[model samples]
Target: MMMFSWRRRRATRRMARGGGGGSMTELTIPSHFLCPISLDLMKDPVTMSTGITYDRANIETWIEGGNFSCPFTNQPLHTIDSIPNHNIRKMIQAWCVENRAHGIERIPTPRVPASPVQVREILDKIAAAAGREDCEECKSMVEKIKILVQESERNKKCIIANGTGNVLSSAFEAFSKPERFEKRVEILEEILSTMAMIFPLQEEAIKHLKSEASMQALVWFVRGEDKSRRRSSILVLKEIISSYPEKVSELGEIQGVLEGVMKLIKEPICSSSKKASLFITYHAIASSSNQEGFTKAFLQMGLVSLLLETLIDAERSVCERALGVFDGICETKQGREEAYAHALTMPVIVKKILRVSDLATELSVSIVWKLVKHESREDEDEEDGGVKVEALQVGAFQKLLLLLQVGCSEWTKEKATELLKLLNNLHRERLECIDSLDFKDLKRTF
Candidate 1:
């Protein structure tokens, strides 16, 4: 058996050399010189609880990615804490030094890992700097925090766990007044940029910035040219408004806030910015009392055309959100009138019924229902001019039937059925009365 083991290994080696049975030079890297996790020479070697060693950055990344087990052992880790493997690091360094003539580069010493205590100290320094009149110190501290956040996702979690968000919110609240906006624009921008990086902000932190004056400052920030600031501002705003939906009405009262949100919806700068703007718009008109004001502002800003444009090419999620906001606008009499007035409004809405998602389908039906209901009354006053005629001519009724044929929520099916019946009634009335109408004039009007 021993002779067979030796022969088998030798045969494998010979085959690896293209079956030439010739001598081949292959370098074998020392296993001890490499990290167990990365299988690369360790620059900042650290040992885990399972007695296996890995590079520090790789382990931290593993931990941040929600792994709590040793990669090699596959055992549930008692604790993720790791200590520097100084001896192994030194050995790797010496090996690199000895192999310098072979083109290996010396590894630089790794910086000491940040501890919770060190992070706490930095947070205090940032708080102190923010309180001081010197914007330079505050800016410096913000830059340092940004670096720490960029170092590891764990660092971001650490800073957030230690009330960094609250401290930053307080600093922003201090400059919430418009009087200080110009003077503190740079510092405020830095703070906002930092906050944007730490997303899914805790409700507590959002509440700190949800005050009237603080929210006003955020609105002003959203209107800025810096797209990063705008993104951060809108994200924060979306979180806050989502939490306290009742407060959305007051946002419409803020000067330039509605317009700022509308501008984002009109020409989305980024996907995130566009989504944030959609959330803000949806929330603003969510309340019945606020719909009148928002509808007026939206129409004045030409959102009907913008929404139609957005719906045509937006991704499914953005399409759903855009449809939601459009439906909200159409709930009001003014909104319904404006939407019906747009030439492409009903057609675009009809196109989205089953093409997007279930939510989008429902919103489209609701908007059509509103338009149809309003136009039914208008048809009584003027026989030939109504959304029903345009919708029928544009094949909206056929889409409605297709909507019913395909499965949807019970409410959607019921609504579509009702709209179908109304459409059929209108079609029958038109056919019965066709003998009295002029065909040439009908073609011109349509």
Candidate 2:
């Protein structure tokens, strides 16, 4: 019993030393068994009987006991008072000593390579098997090849560049052959899916490929004999807007794509697809100033109402993007009036503005002020033409008053006051419309 106690004390001292009296020590473990908390050897490496080792409880305890966090996950340690498995602890100690002796601070685990040889072999197999003409089998093989190429690319190697480029070029070349366009489309789809995964890892290489192969694929798919292929191309173009915005912008003639996307939005066959296409088109338009023609096309397509509908999309990102487009359109005088006219029929616009809380409220209030000021200027010019003052209704003024009353931030309130002064200057008759509200109540609310 004394000998066992002494061994335990020695183990505790070893652990304390590795922990550096609560500071972290760089102790290396097998890449698979490293404890995230200490970035060192794990204690009582809890392997299931099946050889899967993970000690969630031990990890949590170590983290909590020392106020430590996992380096990868950043999760807080919550508890660490129980004894670990003795055999596993011994194994971990032995392994740590072995690694330390070899000066192995961090052993990188083996990862699957994304290489040209692997891609070339997969392409050769596909080419040889072309006589079978089994679409499902072809798709399966293409998907497997794509996955392998993606995995290799993710391993931080440039092995797939030559192979991938050749494969894509051959696939595009095959598109003009009899019964090969469908096969080419399948190959392009696989390549696109793989590119989506590997692009972040090999961005520069992927960008070049996207500008070349992806562009060719998109053009072919869009102009294909098959309607399904055309639709698929549209979907892929939308994906490019997100993954390769810079490259997509370089393609030029975005108006044609915007028109195509807008037409699809009006079709009931693919409502969600249409919405996604429009969302991407809007982003593409917002990304470039030269594409104001696309923006004008959006306005011509009754996009104001569609955009308003999108503000309440189930996807927060979609809603944010739609709002951003709306804000972008309202930046100019003509666009502001166009937006203001649309806002009059949509009460949700005001409700959405209110829901924006302080930050959004401040911005919306400022936008409203600018719109009202512009309208006032227009109203002044119309008076000389015998336009009746009473006939004109400034819809934004009442909303601004309500916004001022409910606004919570000091900045919002001060801006609101400035807006009211501007409105009085534009439509002096409208001053009584807001003065009826208790100024004291507005101040208290703020």
Candidate 3:
């Protein structure tokens, strides 16, 4: 047998130190008994669909490395994981024992990889345990799957190969239904942790995760007190929401979905969590059904104050996302009212004009235009007419003027022209009214 160079050196040292009784001898390994990929003695040989047999670990590494063809013949493979070659394994083992004097160690039988059937059986038991009183059985079963999932990539593939990903999704769906959530919160938390560990979920899993029940459950976990669970939940939630493009009004069904998701943006567990939170908010309002209704929900949750705080302190990407959502909020009359209600909305938004990214600038300009244009859009004027007044007070005129001078998108420049015209009209009106303020009986008017 051809041993590794390090192994040979170790044996030589052992013999020199009078520790080994026999000197090592070199032996030529047989060609057929070796793995073609590694050229090493076959240990746990498995045959691929292409009819090529290789050591189990080597072949698995090949397939997992994104190869879909045989290593030696270059033929495409129909099946992913290879089947165990029992006969070759037995012969390899017998040959190892017969060549004991040649320093060959007999390969033990390989443990069977966890199969989809096994995962299905455990899932059935878990579903049955949901009705029973004691959850210890459920916890143990989930814990077992958790361990198997962590064992290897092959195990993860085997476990969720079937539609059992949906089973786990439904298990997480318990959080949405309070009656079902009574005794299963702990179990659901465990399930969240397990699913988080095995991510990049298949299509079947994502289908249910986008369902109303799972979305609600995900929102709860994102806002939940368990810090670890929140991290896991957001990681999974971001994938589900962003991976699927079609969003619907089912978002409106959740009680505090907006509030729960905002918690992530308000106080993120990590950078990714913050981005995911922003992604959820941006995506939630993406549905036309969610716009008028859920924008009101966000406003009720004090989204204006939260967004201003984020713009002041967040990084470029976060600023872009927060501003994106804020722009969406500004599309509605109530959205404009809520923003105008906030003390620093105009001032802070003006600050963002030239400081952040161009997208941020565009979003901020859009919001300014909406707030100022509400008079024209609704044909109604506010009691104070502060949209134009506040715009001037916050140096918004100069910023918009600077944005125009420095140049921007045609859309932004056009909005800036309108904003400058609005601000200038207000400036001229304020100047024109200055002389009347000195008169004793002057009536103040905008």
> Candidate 1's residue-wise lDDT over 1-446, tens digit each?
01224445656777888785765443334788777777777888989898888988888888888999988889877988888988988888887788675456889877665568877787777678767655778778778888889876657777878877877777777666677668988887888888888877777777778898778888888777777777788888887887888888887788888888987887677888899899988877777776777778878888888989999889998998999989888878788777877889977887776666779889999888878876646464575657777667666676676666656788888888888877786644443222222222222111
Model 2 has an lDDT value of 0.50
lDDT score of residue 248 within candidate 1: 82
- Model 2: per-residue Cα lDDT over 1-446, one tens digit each: 01224434555786868843443334323565554434444533543322334454445454446645443545543432333344655665566557654453332232434445666666675544443444455456667765665553233234355444344334433332435555555655654455434333233333444554455556565544455555655655655555677654554453255555555554423444554565565565565644566567667777777767655542544444455566666665555656756643234344444454445455555555455555654555664411112212423456566766665577767767776665444545543242333233333254
Q: Per-residue alpha-carbon lDDT of model 3 for 1-446, expressed as tens digits?
A: 45557567777888889899786665556777899999998877889988889988898888879999999999999887678999988988998899776566898887778887888899887766654534777778889888888777778877767555666776566444666664667877887888777766877778767877677677677666888888878878777866774553565466665666788778888887788788778766666755787777778888889889988888999899998888888888788888877888987887788777789989999989988878453323555556687777667777776677677899999999998887787644442122222233322232
- Top model by lDDT, which number? 1
By TM-score, rank the candidates, best first. 1, 3, 2
* CA lDDT of every candidate: 0.77, 0.50, 0.76
Superposition TM-score, candidate 2 onto the true structure: 0.49
Question: 1 or 3: which has the higher TM-score?
Answer: 1
Name the lDDT value of residue 215 in candidate 1: 87
Best by TM-score: 1
Provide the lDDT at 157 for model 1.
76
Q: Compute each candidate's TM-score over C-alphas.
A: 0.80, 0.49, 0.59
RMSD of 2: 13.7
In TM-score terms, candidate 1 sits at: 0.80
